[model samples]
Target: MKTNNNGKKSFVQRSLDWIEKVGNKLPHPVVIFIILSIITILVSEWVYRAGVSVEFFDAKANETTTINAISLFNSEGLYYIFQSAVSNFTGFAPMGTVLVTMLGVGVAEWSGLIGSALTKLILKVPNSLLTMVIVFAGIISNIASDAGYVVVVPLGAIMFAGARRHPIAGLAAAFAGVSGGFSANLMFGPTDALLSGITNVALNSSGNPYEVSINGNWYFLIVSTFVLTIVGTLITEKVVEPHLGAYHGDFNEHEASELSLKEEKGLKNAGIALLLSLVVAFLLMNPWFGPFQTIDPETGQKTLQPFMNSGLLFMVFLLFAVPGYVFGKTTGKIKDSNDFVESMIEAMRSMAGFIVMAFFASQLIAYFSHSNLGIILASKGADFLQNQNISGIPLILAFIIFSAFINLFIGSASAKWAILAPIFVPMFIAINLSPEMTQMAYRVADSSTNIISPLMNYFAMILVFMQRYDKKSGIGTLISTMLPYSIAFLIFWSVLLIIWYALNIPLGPGAPVQVSMIQPLIGLM
Candidate 1:
C-alpha cells in the first residue's frame, strides 16, 4: 500500500510538471485560436458524416442537416466566418457582452469601488455564516459576469486567510461556489439572457419559436445557490482545511485592511446617488408618467423591443458606473471625465487575450452549429440514454461525470454550453427532462474540473499568482491542492441534486422537478 501510494504521488507530480512546462511553452492564445478553429472544422466534418442530424419538433421544418465540410468550403460558409470574426472581436461573443458591461465595472474596479464594497458587505456578516456568505455572494456576483471570477474568487481566499483559517480551503470554497457554481445563480446575468437569446434564435431557425424566457433556468439555479454553499462550506472546513498545515508563508500576516472614513463616506454617497438614478431612469421609461414612455395603449406591451434583451448590459453598466464614479471622485482618482473614460478603455485593453480566444471560439461554435454537430450528438446521446431506461438518480450522476470528463478538454463554460445546449436543451426537453436541470448538471461538471484542466486559460494566471506565495509551487502543487475540492464538490453537489430530485423540490419557479412520471417520452423510453 505504501509503495502504491508513493507511485501515485510520483505520477501526479510528473503530470503536473509536464503541464506547467508544456502549458507555458505553447504559442500565444491566438495560435491556440487558429489550432482550435482547424480542429472545430475537422470535428464538424467528422460528426456530420457520422450520420448526425438535429431533430426539430417543428412539423413544418422537420429536421435539418448541413454538409459540414462542403458548407465550409462554399461561399456562404466563407462569408459567415468573415462576418462572424468581426463581431467576435467586437464583442459578439461572451467577451463582448462582458467587455461592454465592464465599462461600468472598470470604474468600480479602478476606483476601488468593488474592493471597498466587498469589504463593507462581508465585514458585517457574523462568523457562523462566513462560509455561506462567501459562497452565496460569489454565486450572486455572476450577475456581473467575470467579476465573480476576477474579484470575488481571490477575495474569498484572502478573506478566509484573514479569518485565521486555511487560505487554500477558502480559495477552494470560493472557487467551488464561484466557478463551480457558475450556472446556478439566483439572478439572470448578461450571459444567461444572451445565451437564451441564442437558443431562441437556434430554435427559430428550425421553425420552432422559443421565447427569450427560455432562460427560465434561473428559478432552478437560485435554489442551487443554497445547495452549493452548504456543500462548499462543508468541504472547506471538514475536508480541505485539515489537509493544509499551518500558514508558513512569509506574507502570512493575515490582516485585512480596514476601510477608511473617506471610503465609507464615498460608499454611502454612492448608494444614495445610485438609488436616485434608478428611480429617475424608471420614471423616464414608465409609459404612465415618464418622459420616454413608448407603450402601445392597445396591447399594454412596451414598443421598446430592444430593452428586455439589452437591459442586463445596461444594468451592469449602472451597477459598476455609479459606484465607480462616486468612489473615483471621492478617492481623487477621477478629477475629470477623461479619467473615467480611460478606466473603461483600460479595462477593454486588459481583455486582449480573451478577445483573441473569442475569435476562434466564435468561429468554432458557428461552424459546429451550422454543421449540426451539437444537435446530432445531443439527439443521439439523449436517445441512447432513453433506451437504457436508467434511473433518474443514476442518470444525473452519470451526466455529471460525463461533463467533468469533457471539461478537461474544454475550459470555457459559455463556449462548451454553446455547443452542448443546442443539442441537450431540446433533447432533454423532449425526454421530459427540463433544460434547466441539464444546465445545472453541466455547470457542476464544468466548474469542478476547471482547476484541474490544463486547458483552462486562467490556470496559467493562477500558477503565476500561486508562485507569489511559494516559489516552489508549480502546476502540480496548484492542481494537487485544488483536486480535492474538485472531487468533493462533484460528490456533494451531485448528492444534493439527487436529494432535491427525490424530495420533488422545485428547481426553480415554473421549473419542474420531474421531466415525466406518467408517460415516458418516445426516445427517452
Candidate 2:
C-alpha cells in the first residue's frame, strides 16, 4: 500500500515537471507571434511559387473558386505591411475593449469599492456554498472584461485563507472559472462581440455571409456556466482542497472583516448610483420613447436594435464608472479631478503588457490574412476531413481536441479565433453545420485548456498570486495544482457538447446546430 501511494505521487510529480519544463522552454508569447508571422510570410512565398491552391464550394454564387496563397515578400506586400502596422494595433478588437472597460474598472479598484464589496459579499456567504459563489463570481466577471483575473482570483485565495481552507485550492478554483470557464458567462460580453465579428468575417470569406448575434451561444453558455460552477466546486472540495490537506501556514483570519460605517455608506451610495444608471439605460433602450430605438425599414416596426448593438459596452462602462465614482467621493478616495485622472491612467498603465502583446498579435493576424494561409489550410484540412467522410460527432470531437491542443501554444482567445474561424466556420457550413455551433465548440475547447496552458496571458500573474501563500510555488506548482481542473473541464465540457449535438439544440437566438444545405455558389479566390 505504501509503495503504491509513493508510485502514484511520483508519477504525478514527473508529469507536472515535464509540463512545466516544456512550457518554460517556449519563447515569449510576443516572440512566438513575431516568429509565426515571419514563417507565414516564408510559407506564403513557397506555396505561391509552388502554385499550391484549393477550390472552395461557394453555395451562394453556385460555382467553385480557387484560392491561392499570396506572398508577403513582394513590393505591394511590403507597402501593406508598412501602411497597416499602426492601424492593426489600434484596430485590434480586444485592445479597444480592454482599454475602454478598464478605465471604469480602474476607478472601481482604485477607490476600493470592488474590494470592499467583494469582501462583504463573500464573507456573508455560507461556507458550504463559498466555493460555488467564488466560482460563479469568477465566471460572471467576464462581463466586466479582465477584472476577474486581477480581483476575484486573488480574493478567492484570501477568502479561502480566512475560511481556514488551503489558499492554493481556492486559487485553482477561481482560476478555473476566470480563465478556463471564460466563455461560460451568464451575460454576453465583449468576447462575444469580438469572436462573433471574426466568425462573421470567416462566414463572408466563405461566400455564405450571415449576421451573428451577441447571444450567439446564449443557451449553451448559460448552461455551461452552471456546469462549470458545479464541476469546479466538486473538484475543489473533493479533489484539490483535500489533496492540499490542512493549512499549516500563517494566514490572517481577520483579513475579511465586517463592513465598517464608512464602507457601508460607500456601498449604499454606490448601489444607488448603479441603480440610477441602470434606470437611465433602461429608458434609453426602451422601444417606446428611447432615442436609441430604431425602426426597421422593411418591417416598419420599432426595435431596440441600436441599443442592443452598442449599448452593452456603454452600459458596462457606466455600470463600473458611475458606481466607482460615487463610491470614491463617498469614501474620500477621489479628492479632486487629478485623482480621477490618475486612476484612469493607472488602469491603462496596468495593461501595458497586454498592449505590447496585442501589437505583435495584430501584425501576425494581418500577415496571415494577407497571405491567405489560414484560408488555404482550412480549405485543405476541411477537404481532408471530407475525404475521410468524418462528419457529425466524431469530427466535432476531433476539432475540439485539436483546438485544445492549439491552446497550449496560443494564449489569446480572440487571436486564435480570428485565425481559425475563417477556415472552420466555412468548412463547417459546407458540412451543413451553423457557424454559431462551430464558435461554441471553439469556446469549449479554448476554455478547457486555459487553466493548464502557461501561454495564457494571466498564467504568470496567477503564479505570482499562488506564491503569496506557498513561497516555493513555481510554474510546476501552479500547473500541477490546476492540471486536474483542466482535464476535468475538457472531458466534461466535451461530453456536454456531444450531448447538446445529440439533442439538436439551438446554440443561441436563431442559431441552430444544423443548417440545410444549398447548392454551392461561386467563390472569390
Candidate 3:
C-alpha cells in the first residue's frame, strides 16, 4: 500500500490498489480453481490421516451425527472425484440458471429491448439517484432468486454506460446489493422459510421445544434492505465510482436521442408481450387447480409454489424471451425464426468463458464438499466460540466475524447454518438470547462478504460480467472494486443490529432478543 508522489490517496485507497494489483497477478480463474482442487485433495488426506472429525447435534434427525473427513487421496474418494465430473458441472446451480435466463436476456440486449429501455430510463432518472435505484432494485430482486445476478448486474453497467458514467461503478453498485444484500428483503422469501425451519429444529433440540416462525427475523431484514441500499449507493457514488474514474470502454455511447417510430412500436409490442407473459404465469401458479401447484401434504398447504421452486426460473425465461423476440421482429432486428434462434446462439457465445470456468469451479466446490472439510471446519469454528465464555455485545461481534470468515470458504448459507445453528442456536438460548437473534446475526454475517468471496456461487458469473466491461479485469479487479462495499456493509449492518438490541427492540413479531420472552409453543406437542 505505497503512497504515490502526491500522496493524495489514504491508506485504505492504497490498500485497495495493492489488493487489486496482487489479486490480478494470481493464476487465471479457471487455473486457480484447478489448483484449489489439488490443494483440497492433499488437505483432505492430511486431515483424514490425523483422524480429524466433528460431531454435532443433527437437529433435523434429533440425534448427534459424526462427520469424519474422507480423503480424496483414498481409492474410493478418487473414484467419486472422477465419477461425478460431468454431473458436477451440470449440477452447479447457477450454470443452468444463467444459460436459460440468458436465452431471453441475450435476445433482450441484442434486440435493442433492454438497450432502448435503459436509454429511456437513464434520461428520465436523475443521475444522482441512479445508484440508489439500482441498489434498491438489486435488494428487491432477492424476492425472485437468481434473477439479480444474471439480469440486474449487467443492466446496471448498461445503464451507467448509457448515462456516460463509469460502467464498472454501476456494476459494483448492483453486485453489492444483489449479493451482499442477499439476506435482506422487505418480504420473507424462501431463505426465511429454510432458515426458520432449521432454527425450529435447533431450538427444539435445545429442550426449548419452541416453534421458530418463518417471520422470526422479518423486522430486522426489512430495515436491513433500506440500510444496505443506502450503504451500497454511498459506496458506489462516493468510493467505487471516484476510484474507478471514467469509462473508456467501447460502450455504445448513445446520446439522449429520441426513439424512432420503429423503436417506439417495438417497445409497445414488447410491453404487450411482457404483460401477456405475466398473465399466463399467474394463471399457471393459481392455487386453485394450477398444474404446478402441490400441497406440502404434511402441512396441507401449498408448499412448492412457483416462486418457491424452478417454476420462477421458467417464468423468468418467458418474461424476457417473449418480449425480446417480439421487439426484435418489430424493429427488424429479427427477420424471422432463424434470426430469433441466432440471437440465443449469440448469447451463448458470450457466455463461453463463464461456461468453461464453471467446469473447474464445479469440481473444486464438489471436492471441497465431498471431503467434509466445510462442515468440519464450520463445526470446529462454532465450537471455539462456544468455549470462549464471552457474552453480550462482545460475544455478538465475535460470532458475526466468525460467521463472515467461515462464509469465505463455505459459500452456501444453509450448508454453513446446518452445522453452526445446532451449536449457536442452543448456546445463545442458554445465555438468554433467542434463536431468532442468533439467526439474524448469522444472516448479516453471511451476506456481508459474498461479493468478495471467490467461492460464492455466482462469483465466476460476475467475473464474466466484469470482463465484458473491462477485458483485462480479473478476480483481483473484481475483489478490489467490491471490497469497499463489503467493508461498509459489514460495519453498517452489525452496528444496526447492535443499536436495535440496545433499544430493546424485538427482532421480529414475538421474537425477542431475550430467550425468556419466547414462548415454548411446542409444549402443546
The C-alpha stretches of model 1 lying farther than 4 A from their native spots are: 1-28, 46-83, 118-131, 142-175, 183-223, 234-255, 281-308, 399-487, 503-525
Task: Give the per-residue lDDT of model 1 (tens digit) for 1-525.
Answer: 112344443454344445545654655545654776676666765654565554433212223333223345446656776777665445433554556666777788778776677666557766567778787877777665555655566567666766655565566567667666776676766656555655554444433333336455666667677777777777666545554446666434444468898888888878887887788677766657654546657457654334434554666577679878987898787889999889888877766545555555555555555555544554455456545666456777777787787677655566556555555555555545655566667767777787676456445444444544455555555666677667877887777777777786766666665564222323311
Highest-scoring model, TM-score = 3
Evaluate model 3: give its TM-score.
Answer: 0.95
Backbone clash count for every predicted candidate, in the order shown: 5, 10, 0
Q: What is the lDDT of candidate 2?
A: 0.76
What's the C-alpha lDDT at position 138 in model 3?
Answer: 92
lDDT of 2 by residue, 309-389 (tens): 455665776788889989999989998999888989998886776677678877877787678776566556545554576
Instruction: For each candidate in the order shown, give its overall lDDT on alpha carbons.
Output: 0.61, 0.76, 0.87
TM-score for each of the candidates: 0.67, 0.72, 0.95
Better of 2 and 3 by lDDT: 3
- Candidate order by decreasing TM-score: 3, 2, 1
lDDT of 1 at 166: 58
